[model samples]
Target: MMDVWKRLLARWAGGSLGGGWGVVLAAGVGVFVPGPEAAAQIVNVQALFDEATAPMGFSGTADLSLDWRTGSTNLIATRLLASAQLRTPPHTVLVVARGEYNFARDELLVSRFLEHVRYRYRLLPWLAVEAFAQHELDAFRRLRARALVGAGPRFTLFSQEEASLVFGVALMGEYEQLRRDGEVDAGQERLDPRLSSYMLGRVKLAQNMSLVETLYVQPRLTSVRDLRILNETLLVVTPNARFTFSMGFIAAYDAEPPATVSRLDTQLRTSLGVKF
Candidate 1:
């Protein structure tokens, strides 16, 4: 029996059980056969392995909702959101897209869409390099279209099982087109340089619930008067491994908006999501 156990240990040390499973076996023994201090060390080792392996795969969420009302005033509203992440060890790619439409009295009240893609590569344990691109259109804001491309460095402030925070700064180039609204010119392209910074936070609120928040600020490199701020907050509840319910809020502000366009916009959303 002693020789058999030694052989098993030798195989485990020789990487015969695959990298993660050896750590799992060690953690199991630490938790079951040892004292509290050993358990803590096991947890730290597991976390290190998790960070190193990074769980290469694809994960995503999609949301769709519609509302219709008939009375003195008829209204219809539709919303759609989708986000996905593909992780390949030390590299990750992400995509997010959303659209909203509203109609009242058979006339369109609002129409807008936004899409973004980002890629990140881990350069060190707490540092990463990132690149991103985005496109947006809002008929209500008289924004015909906008495109942006950027690159930057991201730093992980903290990471643990219960909470995490990350911050990034980037230099971006933007191309914008506005509809002809008094002072604004139609079919005209405006290109500018901007500095952008963002902080993202995630926290576990309960056994089955989590909260995520992101704040972003962007200002023209030449003048701070031309600035934009965006905030997004979400609460998610999971009843099981495969399904989630979420409520989210988004607020955006522009210091210098196009003519006839509001400087501030806000939205509330609720969604049910499935995991695959």
Candidate 2:
């Protein structure tokens, strides 16, 4: 049973964290958007916690992605993600941070930064209690800042060499500040209580290849209609122990978004990750 837990932690270490693909195609539009903009509120923090590169002690990973094009429209996009974890007996700690910038034809299109910290206590081989806090900002989304904190229990439905599934639910308290633009009561400070839930699954396709899927749903406790959803599917290819490559697709939706913000967003991205 201890060996199984070790295997599960090791598998989580391979998962990638925040940021999006450099080339973005807006949903419902066949053409690529001029800028690689995305919603930063829904990041894959679970990836940072799941990957266990080492059975004990501390481990870290860094991933960088860039897209640059020159010609009719000069464009540059860059993203960086870093994560570290410490494991000690029944207690584990994890931290992850990410930054992104995009420029097109000398104009800034996207800029965002995010930081997250999580702590977990393993009460059993198949169950853990977790608490987390996160802070994020996005220039494209006109978000000045957003912060949230939550705690809950997580259940490992199944775990094996070939596949795994996990589910979790939490009560989250959130606050946000948005930038105003000529709208009445725009940029107002807001606070809300939300129910956050997620499901994560992984499947090994081959000796060096695997697939991961994650889904997140957060609904306002006061009004279920005010909901947010995020989904990501990734195909990861590992050539060796230290390096990994992955291609992924992501989609996010907010039933009630801030003024001037779109309710839905999508992205297609590829990234190279290094673990140590």
Candidate 3:
């Protein structure tokens, strides 16, 4: 009986002691030990992969609402759009970043740029036309001498959705001197073929979508140039009216080669577009 009592007391003591040690060990690990996979991480997954896209349209969003962010969609254009606010005697400048589509590329370049700043008369209520000659750079690359001249009428489509619809046509001549980087061509510059009579049709899509279709006839390759044309059908989405994320096909329909550049060919490009 004494032996049995001794055994019971010893077992109880051992169990309590064991539990105490376990509690201490667990506390130590929970307080001081590092996590399992700390060393392998190089870049912050949030920063590297977070969808904080750049701003698109030209006119800036108001300071307060600018804080909200979107997770799904992207900004494809940002521009400083100027519409007429003829409150005073003469309708004056209203600075708003208007989202717009790029010329040759179906992407939106910037919201509103000073295409040509000049003194002109605001002739009609919603219609204004002008002509100007300016040096044309790819606008994105501000390089390669391409001169653009002539102008067309810009009319306001004042619908319920805030003049969101605009249609215009422009006629311009282009001299395209296609040049490659020095490392690739080794300082050899060729007189790249020129494209004349570049025609443009600017079509307004949804609230944040606009489509610009450009048709340019290749100058030199009489057959390919005669037959060669580049048309990009683009879809632009405005996440919060400040930025745009764009993706689309370069050639919607390309004839077989003998001619270069195809139809619905992503061979040219497929990537993210951001405007700042």
Candidate 4:
């Protein structure tokens, strides 16, 4: 069992994700929308969602960042994220949405949007089941849209107030549409089945600080060479019950991407979060 686990981990590491995909996406989307314009739109949408919602066993956090600079070079960058979780008895639900836009010298450098929703039901102390759906769009990558839906089992490795670890495996179906670009075929689309697996861990680092790490792997059922991996690490500092400062690093890799796109994308973000 130990050797089997080691082999699995080695295989995962061998397919580690890369980070140049974002640069490619940014370059591709630069011509369609100006950076400042896109940033404004994201900010407006975030503001609209900031209004309070009636309680329904729901609690969440929201973050917004905006910056503008004026000089020989003018720059604007904005990001907004909102996530909510609902817990009722043995059932739990989570939803997240985020967008980012960046502009430098009046040109759009990056524009992307992502959303995910998940539902889980605890069937036993150590076992649960979950279903999830996700959507993504990145103008820079010339990804018109991608959608995924899946259901799977989640197993608890450890559970405690200050620390926890979990692993999940799911069978998913994905549909993707690609925009016509010089490099990618115009109106490209694919529908495929994939196997998805993930490990998640949370630990308390200090009295008011905590850490979370998650690693996800997805490989096309019909093509093992077509794989994707995502890893995210977050550090959160809570000064009080109502507010938090969080920094996160994300890395994503694709074994086979669109002709024009790179295989890896990476992002780092820091934001102030308010809890309701």
lDDT of each: 0.59, 0.67, 0.28, 0.60
Which model scores highest in TM-score? 2
Which ten-residue region of model 2 has the weakest summed lDDT?
Answer: 20-29
Candidate 2 lDDT tens digits, 191-217: 666788889998999999989999998
lDDT of 1 by residue, 1-276 (tens): 434433443343234656224433333222111000000000001111123213468776676756442322235668777777788867776667778788866677666676666666789889987666555666655666665555777898988879988877777656566666566356555666677777777788999998888777777787888878777787878898677787777666777766555566565657677655
Clashing pairs in 2: 12-50, 12-51, 13-51, 13-52
Q: Which is the better candidate, 3 or 4, if ranked by lDDT?
A: 4
Candidate 1 accuracy as lDDT: 0.59
User: Comparing candidate 3 with candidate 4, which one achieves the higher TM-score?
Assistant: 4
Segments in model 2 whose C-alpha atoms lie over 4 Å from true places: 1-40, 51-54, 66-76
Please give, for residues 159-180, the per-residue lDDT of candidate 4 as tens digits.
Answer: 7768878887777655566677
Cα RMSD, each candidate: 18.6, 12.9, 28.8, 13.4
TM-score of each: 0.72, 0.80, 0.33, 0.73
Please identify model 3 stretches exceeding 4 Å from their true place. 1-122, 132-144, 155-166, 176-230, 252-276
Q: What range of 10 consecutive residues in model 4 has the weakest lDDT sum? A: 33-42
Candidate structures ordered by TM-score, highest first: 2, 4, 1, 3
Residue 224 local lDDT, model 2:
90
lDDT of 4 at 42: 12
